[model samples]
Target: MTWRPAGVMGVAPSLVVALADHLQKLGAVERVRDPADRRRQILTLTEHGRELLGVCAELARSADAEFAADLTEAESAVLTALLDRLTGR
Candidate 1:
């Protein structure tokens, strides 16, 4: 999703700005003025950022599988459903 400064929620605006700055410095993202509106800027992920996110997703999946290794399939399925409910997904 394209994120504008005002779109950030549940965090301090200053923290969001700082994180945005850090991401930009890491070449993870860029902010560009909206073509139709000079007063607004849109944040876009860079190719490197997309790659990093893919790696992160893979690692998360690995960790999740490992965490459930000791559980029976039914238990894991129940846990997954519980987590999905808690996460509002």
Candidate 2:
């Protein structure tokens, strides 16, 4: 998806801005002015960013699987629900 600032939800705007700045600094993303609207900017991920994202996703999946290894299906569901609630998701 094209990254528009408006598409972000449930995150504080300041935190979003800070993350964008950090990513740009790391060469992971670039803020490009929209051609049709020069006043507007769009955040686009660089190749490096895509690679990093893939790695992070894999790590998360591995960690989640390990974390749930000892839990039964019902226990896993309950744990997921409790975590979601704790995170206000």
Candidate 3:
């Protein structure tokens, strides 16, 4: 898989160390040194991060349902199929 920067939301390469330290203090994530490359580290989400993801998923589902409520079932299905085709999924 290709790796892409998280963009502005990411602590860029220059600020990764400081960002890791901040996340550690907040107990939101952890940085682990890769066994194959001691100089490189990967960030993994902590329990708090998983909980936040669940909350966000619920919110996203609610918003999607609301947005599609006005459409007929067939229309909604067609729209979803079109989106899937566009996304190649």
Off by over 4 Å in 2: 1-7, 77-89
Native-to-model Cα distance after best TM-score fit, residue 54 in candidate 1, in Å: 1.0
Candidate 1 matches the true fold with a TM-score of 0.76
Best by lDDT: 2
**Scored by Cα lDDT, where does model 1 land?**
0.85
Model 3 CA deviation exceeding 4 Å by range: 1-26
lDDT per residue for candidate 1 within 1-89, as digits (tens), equals 55655444657777887988898998999999899889766789999889988999999999999999999999999998999997773
Candidate 1 or 2, higher lDDT?
2
Candidate 3: lDDT of 20?
70
Which model, 2 or 3, shows the larger TM-score? 2
* TM-score on alpha carbons, each prediction: 0.76, 0.69, 0.65
Better of 1 and 3 by lDDT: 1
RMSD of 1: 3.0
Per-candidate alpha-carbon RMSD to the true structure: 3.0, 3.7, 4.5
